[model samples]
Every structure is written in C-alpha cells, then in structure tokens.
Target: MNTCFSSYRSLFPVLGDYVHLASCSQGAIAQPISKAIEEYHASLLSVGTNWEESILKVEATRKKFAEFINAEPDEIAIVASASDAISAVATTLSYHHTKNRISLTDLEFPTAGHIWFAQKHHGADVSFIRSQNGMLPLEQYEKEVTECTLLTFISHVSYHNGFTQNLKKISNIVHHKGSLLFVDAYQSSGQVPIDVREMNIDMLCTGTRKYMLGIPGVAFLYIKKELAEQLQPRHTGWFGQEDKAKFDIYNSIYAYGAKRFETGTPCFISIYAAYEALKLLLNVGVEHIHSYLQDLGKFTREFGIANGLKVATPTASSMYSGMTPFFIDEASKVEKKLKEKRILVSSRKDVIRIAPHFYNTKEELEYAINELVQLVK
Candidate 1:
C-alpha cells in the first residue's frame, strides 16, 4: 500500500465497502460527491427551479477541468457526454472534396470512432487503421493520414487492453501531413496529466465518469483557441449564441471560442461533483498519481504473468496506465469469483480489467490477483 494515498482513502466511502479495482469501468464515488448531491437537492428545494447556480456550476467546472489539462477556460466547453462532444466536433468538419478523409484506429472506444465513421454520410472518407498487439504503431498513422486527411482521431489509452499511445509522436505525424489531431482522453484524462499545448493537440474531449472520479451526465470538449474561432459546428444550440445570457430568442450568432460547441441545458448536479473531485485530484497531483499507478500496475502485470495469467497491457511500464487487463480464458468465471469475495473488479469480453486508484491498497490488488490465479487453475 502506498502510504501517500492512505490518508485520503477515507474521503472515498466506496473504499470502506469493497476493494474497488473497477475505476476503469466506473470510478468509485468519493464522500464529497455524495455531499455535493445532497447540497444540490437542498439548493433546488430552496431556490425553486432557479438556474443561476446551475449556469455558474457549468462554467466553474469547465474552468477547473481546463486547469487540470493546462488549457484556458475559454478553450473548454461543458458537454452532456463524451458522444455529444465528439459529434459536435464531427458536425463542424467540412467533408467536401479530397480533404474529407478522417483516420481512426480499431481500438478507439465506439463513441470516439462511430461519430467519425458516421461522417461517411456527410461524405467523409473515413479510414480505419489496424492495431498490432492492441496498440497502434506510429508508422500506420503516418501512412494513412495524408494531405487529403482532414482529421485523425486517436485514443490516449485503450479502454479494452490498457494500451497507451504517444500523442506527441502521433500529433507531429498528423500535422506534417496537413491534418488536425483530435484525441479521445476518456480513458486517460484524470489518471494521467494532459497538456494540450505540450501535445500540440487541435481538439479533445473526455467525460466526468471513469478515471475522473465523478458520475455521468457531464463532460468537456477542449478546442484550440484558433480552431474554436474558425470552426462552426452544425450541432449548435441556443446556448451557443453570441450572448447566451442576454436570452436573444431570435439570434443565430454563435458564442466565441469553445463555448460555440455547447448545446442546451446542462446537468449541474453532476458538474458540481465533478468539480470537487477534480479539485481533490489536482491537489494530489496527476504526476504523483501516475507514478503510483505505474508501480502498482507493474506489480500486477509481473506477478499475474509469472503466476500464469496472460497480461495484455503495454510492455513498457510507463505505457501502462492505471488499468491492467488480465487476458484469462475464463475471464467471466474469474470476475464472478472476485465479486463473491467482496472484491469488486470488471471484465470486458475475455479480459478481466484491474484498475487501482490512488485510494486503493496494494493488498487489495494482491488478493484479487491471487484469486484470479486460483480461479484460472
């Protein structure tokens, strides 16, 4: 157990009940989130449907999210979900002529890939790059992304197999070919540090759920300042108006920057919880969290493999994110066995994915790994 996160464990009541290693599927709720929801209900009762705080929460959460990613508040837009964020960006692209091609990998979560794939309806020549051993090689991206490519979508980390990619390397390739890079950080954001400027990313989106330590119904889309000014998404709604608070019912002019991507009303309750969770995460420091996860994940993969469980995460320990997928033949059986022991973990197809958060203990993971070995035997 890392003594560093031990003190903060009490903040997550989920820790009290189960050995939570399912954060990759759905993060265990923290104590602050429950308190935030109670406050939301109280405020709703007191204010009687007034939405001033709701509006403020949407913006404040966006700023906090931007701070976590090292982006400007103006560059971030609060979205309803990851799918909504990707679709908004997809709708903005002009899929007209030879430059209408979009490239994505087979490993990307469907939310990130499907929207662009559907762009075929709008005349986008979508290209799918194959992955080798659950990871995409930089050479494959360079080959498919050409001068005619309008955008290339890549996942910061694979949700299924826990394979992490080098966005900086991929970004340089896409840019050299005169195309923009859009990243789906849903699996990477809070678990790892993201600096859009450092990665030279054109746009990106991630939800509050999963590694972010928040519930569903809220997400963020980050657009580079220059791209936000030039792009206009067909997915715009009344909230995207130039002066939204002015309540101009007849106006069509969109707001400047990433706000132009925002649609209708937001789910403020979830945003409030997300903000508190991010505040705690920032205080803990993403780099420190990444380091800790690396240590734990390495131990998990090494021990699990040595004991005859096939591990599917990246070979490089740094490439291993918080999650490690143990590719067991009887993954479903193993998952059921773990739950019966009051140790919670998840399985995706034949893969039993183990994710340990900052609040989790080394003993919990060791127990889970040993249980998995015995189940397989």
Candidate 2:
C-alpha cells in the first residue's frame, strides 16, 4: 500500500455511512463540491447579472478539464450530457451520400450508437463490428474500416464488461484509412489516465455525473484543434455564435473550435457542480487515483475468484479499471441479500458490478467480500 493512497481515503466525507462501491455509475460527492455549489448559488441570488463572471468561471473549469485530459482549452466544449456532446461531434463530421459508412462497436453506449444509426435514415451506411468475448477485436475493426468509412466511434471502456480499448492503436488505424475516430469516454475519463494528444482521438465525450462526482446534466466534448475547424454544426443555437452576447443581431457566425457545438443556454448550476468535482479530481491527481483504483479492482477480482464467484471483468490488473464485475449463481437473490445487509452493489443482467473509489477503505472491501461470500454460500 502506498503512503499517498493511505491518506487519500481521508478526503471523502461519504465513507462514514455506506461502503459506496459504485463510483463508476455515480461517484461519492466530496465536501468541496457541496461548498462550491452553495457558493455559486449564493452568488446567483445576490448578484442578479454576472454573465462575464460566469463565462470566466466556466472557462476556468474547461481549462482544468483540458489540462486533466491533456487537451487545449479551445478544444473543450461544455454540453448537457455525454449524448449531447457525442451528437454534436457525430453530426459535425463530413458525411457524403457516397462515402457514408460509419463504423461503430457493438458494445458502444446507446447514445453513441443512436447517433450513427440516425445517419442510416439519411442514406448513410452504419456498420457495427462485434466484440470478441467482451473485447473489441482490432482485426474486426480493420476489416470493416474502408476508404468509404467516414467515422469510427468506440467507447474507451465498455460499460457492461469493463474491457478497455486501446484508443491510440485504434485511432492510428482509423486515421490511416482516412476516417475520423470519435470516442465515448464516459467510463474511462476520471478513472483512467487519458491524453487526447497521445491517443490521437479526433473527438471525445464524457459526462460529469459519474466518475467525475458531479450533478447530472453537465458534460463535455473534446475536438482536436485541427479537426474542430473542418466539421459543420448541425444543431446550432445562439450561444454557438461568434458574438454570443450580441442579442440585437439576428445573424451571426458560429465560433471556432469546440464552442461551435454549444446548442443553447447551459445548466449553470450543473456546470458549477462539475467544476467543483473536477477540481477535487485534479487536486488528488488522476495518475495517483488510477493506481489506487487498480488496487481495489485487483482485490475485488482476486477475492471473488478465491471465494468461488465468477469474475466477469478482465483478469489482467493493468487492463482493469476500478469497475469489477462478478456473478453468483442466483444474481438477483444475491443482489437483494446484499442490499438488505446494506452492502451496496449493482447488477447488470447476471453480472454484479462493484466499483470502489480512492476514498473507499480496505475494510469496506473486506466487508463487501464477506457479505458476498455469505450470500453465495
């Protein structure tokens, strides 16, 4: 156990009550997040109009997120949800009638899948490369990617199986075929160390509600600086305009970079909450957090296997994130028993998912394992 991680558990206030091994779905809110939101709301109530101040705050938040993900501030766009962000990026791609094939993985979230599917109605071909035993096969993707392929959309981590895709390798393949790579990073953003520049991800979308430890209805998209200028906005709003403050003018051009994707007035409260959440994550450091999560994941997997429970996630610790999926014979019964015992865990079909954050303690992990062992027996 590292000394850095030993002190990491002291930061979160929520560890006192429940074990909270579900940060993959929704992270535990830190005290700083609560304070930040309250202060922002108080400002709104006291000062009636502070658009300039609000913009500054929002830009600061974007810069923090960009720095965390190794991207430029100009490349980041604050949106409502991962779906909204992905939709904006997907619609912006240059899709012609002839070269209209959009490649996607079968394991993609519904939001990303639907965006590409809608293109089929517009005479574009949508192709899905199936995952081999919960892993995206590079060979399958290579076979489907053609000169006609306009975009290849994939999830950085599969939501159900917790299998991580090598984005850098995949992006190279897509770029070589002259196609854009759009990544749904909802599962991997905060939990894993990501660098957009190194990965060569053309576009990426992630929500703040989950591992980001924020309120819902706030998300962001990252578009490569070079590619941002090439795509056209499909659903443009006043905020997307170059002169967003010019209300008197009916006509205005969309701004450059990822801001061109902003559809309308954003949820200010949600953004404020997201800002606080991101700040906490930044302070803790993503690399350190990822290393801690890997330990938790390894513990959960090894414990499950030792106790005769089925391990569903990848066995390789390096490839795994905080998310640990396992199963007992009667998953529903086990879930109910665990919940009744105040041992929180979620079930997806037959697999029980356990995702612990940096704040969670080894005691909590042991308690969860004990409860699971009792239920299995």
Candidate 3:
C-alpha cells in the first residue's frame, strides 16, 4: 500500500468488498462524504435556515479548488451542474456579430456540446470536429478553428475513452486566431493537474460528482479574471447582484468576478459534500494522483493488449488516464459478467470503461484484468 494514499483507503471502506473501476461514472463515497451529509442533516434539524456556515464552507472549498487548478478563488463559481455552468458563460458572449463560429469536438460529452449546439437558433455557427478512432487529433482543431471562430470548446479528458488532450497547444491556436477557449474538465479534475493561467484557458467547467468524489447537483466554473470582471451573463438573479441582501428592486448591479455568474440559491447539502470531497482528494494532491494513474494506465493498456482486447483509448501511454475503454462485443453483457464477479465498471455503446481512482490497488487491477481476459473475447 502506498503510505501517501493509504489514508484514503480507510475512508473508503466500500472498496474492500468490490473491485470498483468506475470512478468516471460516479466516484466512490466514503467516510468524509457520509460525515458531511450527517453534519448537513444535523444542521438542518437544529437551525433549519442558518446558511452562514454553509456559505463559508463553500468559499473555503472554492479556494481549495482554485489551489488545485492554480487559479484565483474569485475566478471560481459554484454552479448547479456542468451544463448550467457552461450555459451561463455562453449567455455572456456575443454570437450574432463578427466571429460567430463556435468550434467543438464530437468527443466531448453531450452536456458540453448541447449548450453550444442549441445556440444555432440564435445565429451561432457551431462546427463539430469528428474523431476518427475514439480520439480527436490536434490537427482537427486547426481545421475547425478559423478567423470567424469565436470560441474553441473541447474536453480536457474525454469521458468515453479517457484521452487527455494537449490544452496548451489548443489554447495557443485559439488565442492566435483571436478566439477564446473553454475546457470541460469533468473527466480530468482531481484525476489530473491543470494550471489555467499556464494553459491560457478563458473558461473551464467541472462538477464535484465525477472524479471529485461527491454527489450530483453541484459543480464549479472557472472564468478568467478579465471575463469574470467584465462580461455580464444574460441569465442571473439576486445572488449574482452586487448587493444580494439589499433586495433593491430597481438596481441590477451584477457582482464582480465569478460571483456575478451565479444565478440562485445553491444546494446546501451538495455544497457541503463537495467541500468535504475536495478536502479528501486534495490530501493526495493532483500531481501524485495523476502520476499514479499514468502508471496504472500503462499497466491496464498492456494488459488489454496482451489479452487481445481492442483499445478505444489513446495508443500513446502518456495520454492515458484512469479510464481505459476496451472495445467489446455486447459491452453491456460483458459488464454484467464483471458484475457477477463482484466488479464494478461502466459500458458506453460497445465499450466497457474502467476508471480506477488512487484508492484502487494494483492487485485489484490485476484481478479485474484477469476476469476481463476471459470475458472480453
């Protein structure tokens, strides 16, 4: 056991009974989450409406998440979901005028692309770059991005196959073309390290549910400082106003920074759970987690290759994350087979996806691989 991550194992007692390799679909719930939920319920039962404590914890979690991504606290906004977060950012932009094209990839999760695609009614020209073999080549972005391109939207890590893209290169191209870059890090945050400043990301959205070790109904959005301070979102409420407590009907002064992007009251329980998850995941640190997953990816990739399994993820070892989707006939049935053996994974289309977190042990991976070797063909 890695002493650095051994502390996490005790928190996640559920892993002892099952070989859980589906962290991408939903992360494992542990002691911290249970305790956080218990505390949330206790507070509701006692005070019922005292939101000051919960609000403070949300702010603290924002700072911690900012630290994880090397971003400023004010740049982060707590959102209801990734779809809402990206949509809020979308509402702030001008799509009717010059540079009306929105460039995105087919590899992105539906949540990320749906928001942009819906903009077609508003005269936003959306172009989707298709992937040839479960991975979008960087050149695809070059082909998609043009002078008329207003923004380049892509996933930091693909959900289906766990292919991590080169953000710096994409960001550079987007900037050189005088366009903005938005990254959906739903499959990357906590499992990978990111520096928004270094990567030149204009905006980024991710939820605490997937890979962040929390439940649904809560997410965070990082809008670059300038955009957060300047651009005004079309959809917002009192929570986004400069003086939310004042209750002034006439005045509509949006708050500066990411706070302005917020709409209404947040899910307090979800916020509490997300805060706790960030604390636990940050303990292992993203750099260490990322490095550990890379090694595990190498192991899984080799195991998959040796077993005559078809790979849907990146062939290059360095680009792999915790997720390794093997192409299997009747993947849903194959997943059922693994489930019969007390292993947990996910199936998308014909691909069986396995995502192991830092808490997962090598023996568990080997055991899962052994079972898969028989079931894959």
Question: Top lDDT: which candidate number?
Answer: 1
Q: Write the per-residue lDDT of candidate 1 for residues 1-377, one digit (tens) a residue.
A: 55788899888887787888988878888888778877888988987784888778777888899899989998998889989999999988898797998988888887766788788888999888888777787889878888889999888988888888889999999999999999999989878889999999999999978889999999899999999999987998888878877877776898889998998888888888998889888988989988888888888888888888888875753577879998888777778888888778888887999998888877888888888787778
Query: Worst lDDT window (10 residues) for model 1?
Result: 313-322
With a 3 Å backbone cut-off (N, CA, C), the pairs that clash in candidate 2 are none
lDDT (C-alpha, whole model) for all candidates:
0.86, 0.81, 0.85
The better-scoring model by TM-score among 1 and 2 is: 1
Candidate 2's residue-wise lDDT over 134-198, tens digit each? 77677977888999988888888877778888899999889999888988899888888899999
Better of 1 and 3 by TM-score: 1
lDDT per residue for candidate 3 within 130-161, as digits (tens), equals 88666777777777788899888899999888
What lDDT does model 1 reach?
A: 0.86
Each model's TM-score, in the order given?
Answer: 0.96, 0.93, 0.95
TM-score attained by model 1: 0.96
For candidate 1, the per-residue lDDT at 256 reads: 83
| Model 2 CA deviation exceeding 4 Å by range | 1-3, 48-50, 316-318, 328-337
| Best of the candidates, TM-score | 1
Question: What is the descending lDDT order?
Answer: 1, 3, 2
